[model samples]
Target: MAKTFASVGDLAEKTISFTELGPGLHAFTAEGDPNTGVIVGDDAVMIVDAQATPVMAQKVIERVRSVTDKPIKYVVLSHYHAVRVLGASAYGASEIIASEKCRAMIHERGQEDWESEYGRFPRLFEAADSIPGLTWPTMTFERRMTVYLGSRRVDLMHLGRAHTAGDIVAWVPDAGVMFSGDIVEYRSACYCGDAHFGDWPATLDAIAALRPKALSPGRGDALIGEAKVAEAIALTRDFLTSTYAPVAAVAARGGSLKEAWEACRAACDPKFADYAIYEHCLPFNVARAYDEALGIDTPRIWTAARDREMWAALQG
Candidate 1:
């Protein structure tokens, strides 16, 4: 068994953490891999961000079953990333929910993303053959959607564009717990292949304003206390700022994409040296940052071939 996947620079192991965020909410975080949130309600359960494969999702399902026997009635996708939604079928949720923009993104480039991510990190896509097909949302909303699990209210809000144009945050008001998809990561590389680098900070500000007592970020350990929650958000903000600022500055000075990539690497390498997937993510992150810094708000599509070309260009 391949216990870990470290690409010369990434320092994180494939570790999973099951945290009790509140009375009936939990977070399953796996280093820098996609995290899954569990909400146990009076009638059933709701899961946020299924893993990349049915086999991998079963690990999350096992943990959920350890806590509650309630059937999973809802599976909320934070975005259209293949690693985040490919395992939706495993949850068997009655409704698969996402933002309208997210659904549209899925319709637009979901297949290409699947191939792109599988190529970039094969270890994360274990049991790839088990994926039935491209996962689609059964229900989608333009702005906000309030889902009730019996009497408990779970509000899914599209705060703003950060990681992607359709990123959504799941807020359990009663629990004071927020499940921030890839919008926030704790000591994890912020993958920016399809990111809005310029607008990402504003999105983080919206999340910080929530003052969550506990937060389940996309990676690393779940934040249990208010202090830790703030730290996670702060760390994520710092990482994004450090990664984009220098690259943008270089781009403004008529520097080439390759130069901007090196600048980004030089500036961020020391700051985020200990962060997870720092190496594997920086090449893609820098490429997007360079583009967004030049006023390209919407990120370019990243197919498997494009990913390799970008990586090779930025790397050399």
Candidate 2:
């Protein structure tokens, strides 16, 4: 039997855990689901990566309210994925911030991504009808921008491209904590549909140089110590290399995408088979790696039709 497209068959809701990594730094993780980071500054709060819709984001807001009554001042988009950014309205944040390239991506493929992702992950898009429309960043920066929540410094930096061309990390220097968006996933399969495989390892190296005491990854549990932080980063690196290398090799030999997919599955499944979204991400990841190896620097847009077409070809 053919597999469902993306995460269509994944309907079970995950248990949510809000963990405190530092004094006011928190990670809201949901059992390998997309995680959200909260930074409570002296006066206000900032949310990194909004949920899929307003209804879903309300749950996050409720959690934020439990800790501090300060208004949510900023909503940051780690990248322009529909599941990450469409919930901006729920926060009612004064400023919605993202990298300049991220904003451009929203303009370029936001609608198509919204359609594609919703079809793949229906559970994540609860109350899909509640979504007003595409989320737009009110403010955009080039490389790095620092926002002071009272006296605390929160640095938002684009640490090169990994997950997407516009991926950004939220660094809290004083606490030695980092909120790495989708750039790093701990025990969770890296979603490489829109990824830049060639540049990803270097991006992971940039994250390692920070030596964060606690790091909140895009998925899975929060890494709370130096050892755990290092482990998560290394695991993420190994995953990227293992997944891309075999597929790239196949493509280099002018192999078909199906052959590349099979090669990637063979290479990655031994270790990553039990990881969350491993099956869902494999086909797309291999497809992207295949394209990148064949000299396509920019990723092609994935519409809902393209998603099913690719999945059918690979899984059939």
Best by lDDT: 2
Give every collision pair in model 1: none
lDDT of 1 at 190: 87
Deviation in Å, model 2, residue 279 alpha carbon:
0.7
Worst 10 residues of 1 by lDDT: 1-10
Instruction: Compose the digit string of candidate 1's lDDT tens values, residues 54-117.
Output: 9899999999999999999999999999989999999888999999999999999999999888
Model 1 lDDT at residue 146 = 98
TM-score of each: 0.95, 0.99
Which 10 residues in a row give candidate 2 its minimum summed lDDT?
1-10
**For candidate 2, what is the lDDT?**
0.93
Tens-digit per-residue lDDT, 1-316, candidate 2: 2256778889998999999999989999999999999999999999999999999999899989889999999999999999898888999899999999999999999999999999888999999999999999999999999999999899999989999999999999999999999999999999999999889999999999999999999999999998999999899999999988999899988899999988988888899999998888888899999999999999999999999899889976
